[model samples]
Target: METKLTPGGIVWKIFKIIIYSLMVFFSITFVGIFVWVLINSFKTAPDFMQNALGLPEIKWDYQNYFDIFKFEYKNNNLFQMLGNTLIMIAINVICTISFPVMAGYVFGRMEFKGRAKFEAFLYVLMTIPVIGGASAQLKFLSALHLYDSYLGIFILSSGAFGSGMLILTSLFRGLPSAYAEAAYMDGAGEFTVFFKIYYPQAIPLLSINVITSIIAVWNDYMTAYIFLPTHPTIALGLQQLQRTADVHGSDYPLMFAGIILTMLPVFIVFSFIAKNIFNSKDIGALK
Candidate 1:
C-alpha cells in the first residue's frame, strides 16, 4: 500500500530532518574538539604546536598528568581541593534536601494562618535576581564572624528555601493524606510520619537533586573564589592555572592535560546519569 505524503506532512518531515542534521553536526564538532584536546594532552609543548589537531608524533608524554597531581594553588593540592569540593556538595545536598522536604511537607500539608502568604513570599524572593548583595552579606557574615571559612560557605549554601522548596512543594502537595492520618491514628508523631512515610516516597526526587547539586558545585568556581579562597577546588585551581600560565609561561600540553583531568569527573558523572535519566521510574507520583 503506497500512500502519497501530503504537503503539510512533507514540510514536517523536512523540519525534522533539518533538526536531526543540526544535532548530528554539532555532536560531531564537539567530539572532534574533545579528541583534538585529548591528543594534544599527551604531546610535548613543541609537538602540540607542531601538529595541534593531529595525533602525537613525538614522545607520548604521560608526565603531564603526573605534574597535575603535583600542582598546587594556595598550598592546596588537587586532592585537597577535590575534598573541599566534595564537602561543599555534601553540605549543600544535606541542607537543600532536608530543608525542602520539611518545608514542602509543612507548606503542602499543614494548613496554618498566612501559609499561602508565606508561600507567595518565597516565590517573590525567587523572582528577585540577586546581583552581588556582597556588601550587606559581608557585613552580616562578619557580624557572625563566619567570613572566609568553611562554616560560612556551609551556612550560606544551606538555606532551606528557594527553587528546591518550590519543586518539592508540588510533590508533597500531591501526596495522599490518608497515610499520614493512619500514622497519626497509630500514635505516630508528625516527625515519625514524615520520616517513615513521606521521606521514603520522595527519595527519587531527592536522589536526582543530589546528583544535580554535585555537578553544579563541582563546576562552580566563583562561590569558592569568594568564600573559600584559601581552599581552592578543582575549578578554582584551573582558574589559578590559567593566571599562572598568563604571567609565567606554562607547558601548553601540561595545561591541556590538567584541563582534561578536571573535566573528567563531572563528565563521567553526567554521562552515567544521562543514560538512565528517562529509564528511571516516573517521578513525583508516590508509591
Candidate 2:
C-alpha cells in the first residue's frame, strides 16, 4: 500500500538513503582491499599484473608460504626473523600489560602528595615521540652495554610511557570504590585491596590495552629498524624484501605471504580477546 509522504518523511527517507550509501561504500571498499590482498598473496608477479583485479584462476600457491620460511635473498634467515619478531612482541606485551595495570591502579586509587603532578608528568611525556628519544635511548643503552641485545629491545619496548597508562587509569577510576573500602574496613592491606578487589575489576580494560599494545609492537617497523637494524624481525624482513625487489623484482606473492604470516599471531590473539573488548561487563566497568 502506497501512503502519502509528508515533507518530514521525505527528508528522513533521503537521509536514510545517504547513510545507507555511505555504509555500502565503506563496506565494499574494505572487502575489496581484503580480497585483493588475499588474492595477491597467492599470485606470481606476472599473474598479479595481468589479473590484478580478478579472482585466482589457479589454486592458491603454497610455494609463497614455503618460500617465506626457506628463501634467502639477503643474509637474514626468515625463521630467525620470525623468532626475533615474536620475542620482541612478547616482551612488549608482557611489559605493557603488567606495568600499566600496577601503575594505573596506583594513579587511580592510591593517594600521594605529588599524585596530580606525577600524572601530569606522564601526560606531558606522552607528547614526546619515541623517535625523538631514540638517540638518547641508544646512548643510555650503550652506556649500560645493552646495545644490540634482546634485553635492550625489551627494555625500550616495555617502558609503558604513554596513553596506555592513562587509559587504564580512567578505567580504574570508573570502578566502584565500595569494594576497596570494604576490603580496607576488613583490615586488608593496600596490596591486598588492589590485588583482590580492584585488579579483578580491571581485566576487560587490561585485555583491550594488551591487544592494542601487541598489535602495535608486532606491526612496528621504525623502532625495530632504528634500534636493531642488523637484527631483522618479521617487519624488518618484509621491508628488506621490498627493498631488494629491484634485484629479485616482482616477488609480490612471497612478500604478501610474509605479511600474512606476520599478521597471523596478532589475528589469533585478537580473536580470543575480541569478545572481552566488546563486552565491558565481562571484565569490569569502564563507565
Candidate with maximal lDDT: 1
Q: Write the per-residue lDDT of candidate 1 for residues 1-287, one digit (tens) a residue.
A: 98899999999999999999999999999988877778889998788777877788878889899987888999999899999888888888888678878888898778999999988888888789989787777777889988877788877877777666666777888889899898899999978998999988888777777777888999899888877778888899988888887776647778789889978988888786774556655343332
What is the alpha-carbon lDDT for the whole of candidate 1? 0.82
Q: Which stretch of 10 consecutive residues in model 2 shows the poorest summed lDDT?
A: 278-287
Q: Cα deviation of 242 in candidate 1 (Å)?
A: 2.0
Evaluate all candidate structures by whole-model CA lDDT and list the values in order: 0.82, 0.78
**What's the residue-level lDDT of 47 in candidate 2?**
80
Candidate 2 residue pairs in clash (backbone atoms < 3 Å): none
List TM-scores for all candidates, in order.
0.91, 0.82
Regions of candidate 1 where Cα sits further than 4 Å from its true position: 248-250, 279-287
The local distance difference test score of model 2 is 0.78
Candidate 2 stretches with Cα past 4 Å from truth are 1-16, 57-60, 73-75, 121-131, 278-287
Q: Put down candidate 2 lDDT per residue, 129-238, tens digits, no spaces.
A: 65767789999889998887889988876665456667678778778888778878899998898888888777767767778777887788887787776677777777
- In model 1, the Cα lDDT at residue 55 comes to 82
